[model samples]
Target: MSFLGFQLRWNSVLLGALVTAAVLNDVPPSYEALVVLAPVIWADRTTLTWVRIRRR
Candidate 1:
């Protein structure tokens, strides 16, 4: 599936599923995965901010 112009890849989907499962099971995600995800999360937030500014 695509969001905006970004294509959601299988690994991204799978990782999201796994993360959800972990949360439901009351398990914390590993620091390594968090580190890997940090930039992507930041970029998403930054992009959202940019889009909001552009829309106004």
Candidate 2:
């Protein structure tokens, strides 16, 4: 799979896991921050992928 495809799959899994953890743990503030940061990290990965592709 392409980098983006791989990233999407893993990100989905990570998000699911985070959601499950939050639910089980009563949604801690740190988990909330991590949940929010997940997408930002994913976005950064996407930007890096594009930069890599462009460089090649």
Candidate 3:
């Protein structure tokens, strides 16, 4: 799979796990921050991918 595909799958799993943890622990800000940051990190990865693809 491509980098983005792997990232997407990983993010999905991470998100689920984090969400479950948050639910079980009453949604702490750290976990909430992680949950929010996942997408931002993914967006950065996506931007990097485009740059790499374009450079090829």
Give candidates' CA RMSD values in order. 7.4, 8.2, 8.2
Tens digit per residue, CA lDDT, model 1, 1-30: 223544455556556876897889998887
What's the alpha carbon RMSD for model 1? 7.4
How do these models rank on lDDT, best leading?
A: 1, 2, 3
lDDT (tens digit, per residue) of candidate 3 on 1-56: 23443334455556567668888989654966777866755754322242224444
The global C-alpha lDDT for each of the candidates, from Candidate 1 onward, is 0.61, 0.59, 0.58
In model 3, the worst 10-residue window by lDDT is: 45-54
Clashes, model 3? 0
Q: What global local distance difference test value does model 3 have?
A: 0.58
The candidate that achieves the highest lDDT relative to the unseen native structure: 1
Error of 2 at 2 (Å): 26
- Inter-residue clash pairs, candidate 1: none
Tens digits of per-residue lDDT, candidate 2, 26-51, equal 96548667878667557544223432
Q: Which stretches of candidate 1 lie over 4 Å from their true place?
A: 1-19, 45-56
